[model samples]
Each structure stands twice: as C-alpha cells, then as structure tokens.
Target: MKAARRALPLLAVLLAIGAGACANETHTVPAMPRPDEPVEGFDAHSPGEARIGATPADVMRMLAEDGKPSPTEHALTPEERRKLAAAFGALTPLHRRVLRERLHSISFLDGMPNNALTSPADANEPHRLFHITFRAGILRENLSEFLTQKERQCFDTAGSSRSVSIEAGTMDAIVYVLLHEATHVVDGGLRLTPGSAFTKSAWSDRTLIAPAFRDPLLARVKFRREGEVLPIDRAEAVYAALQRTPFVSLYASSNWSDDLAEAVAWYHLTERLGQPYRIVIRDQGNQVFAYEPMKSPVVRNRFDALSKFYEEPG
Candidate 1:
C-alpha cells in the first residue's frame, strides 16, 4: 500500500511554499556540473563589492532599466533595512557570494509574490542584471505567525529526554528565507536545478522544466510533477505525505526545484547550523505521529545529494 500524503493548511503558503512565474515555451539545459567552476581568484562564497540594501533612487534606476516598474514597490523603513542587511551578513560566506554574483540589487516592495528574482526583459540589455525583492512587512509577519504555531505542536527529538518543537524566531525565519531565495539565485547562476532561468531573456520570464535529477532523489521522495497545485484537505495529510517522501518540508512538495531549495535550507539549518526541524500530529491532546527528516534514513539520503553543492572541496 502507498503511504499517505500530507496536506498543509493554506496559511503555510504565506510562509515559504510557492513557485515563481515561468515561460510558456520549455527550454532544456544540462544538469548542474559537479564541483562548480570557480571564478578566477575570486571567492565564490564571500561578499565583495556587491551592495546589500537599496534606496528609492536605486529602486527607480532598476525599474527604469527594466523598462517599467511594477508600481507596487515602496521604500523600506530603517528597521526593515537593518534586518535585511543583517540577514545578508549572517549568510555563510558561500551563500553571500551566490547573491552577490547572481543578483543585481536587492529591493523592497510592499507586496509581491512571496518574493522574486527578476531578470531584465529587454534583449538589447546585454548585461544580465538580476534584481531580487521581497515584501518586508509581510515576510516578517508570516515568519512570526508560522513559527509561533509550530511551537505549539508536539515534536520528537533524539538528544533530549522529552520531545519539543524547535524554537523558530524572526532571525531564524530570515536566515531560512535568505537561503531559500539564494538557492533560486544559485539555481539560475549555476544551472544547479533544472527549469530555472539562465539566459538573459529567459530570466525575465522564468520557467520550471521538470528536471531528471541523476541522483534519483526525487524518485526516492515520490515527487509528483503533474502541476504545482496540490490536492490537500486535512492537516494530518501533511504529516502523512512527509512520512513517505524524502522532502524536508511541506514547501518542498511544490516542485523539484523547491525540493532542492527546501532540502538545502534544512540541511544547512539542522546539519550545519545545528538548528532543529521536524513535524508532528497530536491526538486527544497527546502526541501520536511525528517525522523528523534529519533522523530518517531516506530523508538523509536525499540531503546527501545537496551537501555536495554547499560544502567546499578540499
């Protein structure tokens, strides 16, 4: 018999589960190369001259460069700006390099799709100027709400005598979001995951062509590629789905690309950063079912494939 699939509530979508726009026409590309090629004498993971925060003038300049602004963007406040800079600074040097190299400017807007990495639409613009933006207020609100609720859920862990939910906070959420978005940038820059924008033109209209990952991680996870929309009704189904698949989180089920991003983020969080991550369900006010990817063999196997990309070669 097949294992039951998990279904997350709509609220979860507000946190970190969704796909960006993709072009109608499908474009094929080779899988990410093993041991990514390094730029001459440049540390691919460190922040160099690349700027972190953007002013209104800079936002306008970026809009003009794109030929037109969305009209939805607004100036970020001092607090929001500080949080963003700190988030960028906190990233592993390697992650910092990914954003520095792939993104042109990190802008703030009132609301947009969860967050997006935009490339110039014009063909004449030879330089590949990539701009990544997020909704400053909404992002913070969502992160707080999501983490707060998770704290109530019962979780099972190894090291501790009693089980408990991981303590997730604003900074924790910020770091996760940064790594998640950075993965998108790395996906485009290194052709790390299939179906992401690479060329100057394709960048404007992103596309997610299903990737045939050589490592068979997707297959092991039992990922379905029919469409981004998932049929989920009950909260219990979410844990059921996770129990069977190797996906690290509910958001990863959206697609293979998300799977990679979510997996990488959790891997770094739990394995590298020593943060806690897990899922659980209660019955009659008692803990009954729980799943922690870091402790599962199948889940760890999928994460093993992601380690190669983030870890430096000796």
Candidate 2:
C-alpha cells in the first residue's frame, strides 16, 4: 500500500515542504559548457512562447516521489489553452520576463487537492528550471468564489451557518492563481525574499521571523501550526491577530517564501489590477466583520520592498 499523503495547508501547497528543505538538498543537473547554454531544454523566448498542455510523465513521477496523490492529467482543448494563454499574458511585465527566462512549462492536473503548485524542474537549478501545475477545476470558476473556497479551508464551521470568505471581485480564477504561482517562480529565480532586503526587517530566514512580527494566536492557526485549525468562532480574532503582523494573509504567515508570494500577488491584484481583496465573516447570513488587507497601513508599508518586481531588469 502507498503511504498516506498529508493534508495540504492553504496556499502552502508547494511540491516540496518548504524552501529550507530545498536548500538543504542537492540535485544533479546536466553539465553545460556555458552559463548561457539552454538549461533542461526550456527556451521560451517570451511568456507567450511557454508550452502549455497535460502534465508530463516526469512531473507526475516527481509528484509521486514527493508523496503527493497521483492526480490525473488534463489535456487542454484549443479554447481552454487560449483562455489560459490570455491569463498568462495578463501577468505583470516582471513576471513575464522572469518566467520567459526560467519557466520550463505550464500544465494542468485533475483532482488536485490544492489550487496550484510550483515546482523546480531541477532542484539544483530552481531559478533556471521550473514548472507550474494548476488544478483543472479552477478553469470553470471566478476569482471571488475560488479564493473564498481556499480561505475556508483554514476554519472548521462546526455545522453552523457562520462562515468566512474572500471577496476578490470578478476575474478568472486562473489569473489570480497564475499571478500567485508565478511570483513563486520569480522569487525562486531572483531570491527576492529569504536573506534578501525584502525580508531583513521581519524574517531571519524562511520559517523564522523577528519577535515583533510573531503572534501567539496567529501561530496557532492553520498553516502556521501544522495540521491545526481554529474554530469559526475565532475567525475575527484570527484576522485581528493577522493585522498586527506584516503578513497579508494567514497562509503568508506560514513562511517567508509564501510571505513574498502572497504580498506581491495581493499588491498586484488590488493596486495594479483594480480588484478588491476583502475578507468577510458572517453569522447566520449577516455580516460580522470585514477586512480589506490592502487598506492596512502596516501592510501597505511593505509594498516598497516589492518594487524590485516592477523595476526593469538590469
């Protein structure tokens, strides 16, 4: 019998458990005579040139080796591929540039338990070899509903009408997920956080942070605490505690890697794409609390560090 796969954490659905694990392991890459020689056969001259299709067998093997459930691959129809291409095209200039240089390909998998995952094609050369896999079901959903579903995973409703949801407004779910996952690719390629200026003030390393940025309550919730969840009754307290930290979402608090990805994605979503990222809680169909993360001064101050993503590559 195969070993049981562990439950995935919200927005922490990486192929590898954490950046620290990847950093500690050594992976072999094909010997190249020059740094400019193509790495692992990925040569997309532009983002639009990225190859899109069903998940390749090698990727499926990687997932199996990582102890992830083996999900069926989804072959894209012409129309589906076009829509995905359009969403890919909608990413920021920096995302496009970095992906064109580092991305191996983009693929879809059916029955994936998480929204999406980004994995390096060659662990030793993450910046040069990366592939992204998205759940196929998201193709049929919009941003608000998709995000609402993802956010709900952190709470146990306890069979009540009380609920928590995200209001990201109307946009293709793929666009937001792509923006988020591509940031992971860029961060891997550029080392935007984790030991860089972007994280110096708050993070000592990927999974360690300064005392001022830590919260006892937030530490006990969802991804922050492995396999643990706060009741829906604590949703307000959760968001309140989250506001005190620099993290923009509960998932971001999991580690510094996600911190950069979530911050950049939300900043791009609200500031550049003109979308709303409001978190609302409700009790028996009536609103209880709402939070617009971008409006928070504490969170907005962190945006200055994200300017590197927008700067023209030197």
For each candidate, how many residue pairs have backbone atoms clashing (under 3 Å)? Answer: 11, 0
> How accurate locally, in lDDT, is each candidate?
0.45, 0.69
Q: What RMSD, rounded to one decimal, does every model reach?
A: 11.4, 5.6
Worst 10 residues of 1 by lDDT: 1-10
lDDT for model 2 = 0.69
Q: What's the C-alpha lDDT at position 55 in model 1?
A: 28
> TM-score winner among the candidates?
2
Candidate 2 positional error at 94, Å: 1.4
